[model samples]
Target: MGERILIAFNRTRERTVAAKTRVADTPASRAVGLLGRDGLGPEEGLWIVPCAMIHTVGMRFPIDVLFLDREGRVRRVISDLKPWRLSPWVWAAHSVLELAGGTLRGSVQAGDRIEFDG
Candidate 1:
């Protein structure tokens, strides 16, 4: 809840994936990710490091999930995942990026590189 970091997806020709992304690097932060929140904005996202699978057990809205490797390259992408849905386990993923529903519908794709900007 402090300062947010900017994120960009290199493979997308339309727009940036997320303009303000919050890093959930800690266990506590990762565990409480996006739960009980109203909704995710178009330009907001959550980056969960060291994560491969996630369950939207108590989520209020749908979201787009991207599984990425250690180098910030996307390995898999799930768009418009409804609440209570469970994501498939991506063995090659070193992290997970959660964003607003339909965020990656026609924008992002697998193998795209992601970067954090100041």
Candidate 2:
């Protein structure tokens, strides 16, 4: 796991989506994201910085992805992204949040704002 942080969704009444989000800011951490992990906990997530795309080539489970811009505004959301799949490049995104599958169904969406707290 990386540095733990809290993720809050501002648009949804300041709801806390992820309370144990990890930061993957380094090259090594980003490349090895979620690999070898069985699955993510209910409130667990990974935040990859300076990323525009992601893949689950050898992953064992599905996830929900949030593409965020520099100001922490969500540009796109991909839900239930299964293993062995690749995500489309988000040109305006500056980071990405990978959460457990079904986590974003009604709690988050595109155009939302995200807040990170250490």
Error of 2 at 84 (Å): 0.3
lDDT of 1: 0.86
lDDT of each: 0.86, 0.89
Q: After superposition, how far is residue 34 of candidate 2 from its true place, in Å?
A: 0.4
List, residue by residue over 1-115, the lDDT tens digit for candidate 2: 5465766555545788888898889998899999999999988999999899999999999999999999989999999999999999999999999999998787787888898
Residue pairs of candidate 2 with colliding backbone atoms: none
Clashes of 2: 0
Candidate 1: list runs displaced more than 4 Å.
Answer: 1-4, 11-15
Clashing pairs in 1: none
Name the candidate that leads on TM-score.
Answer: 2
Q: At residue 99, what lDDT does model 1 achieve?
A: 94
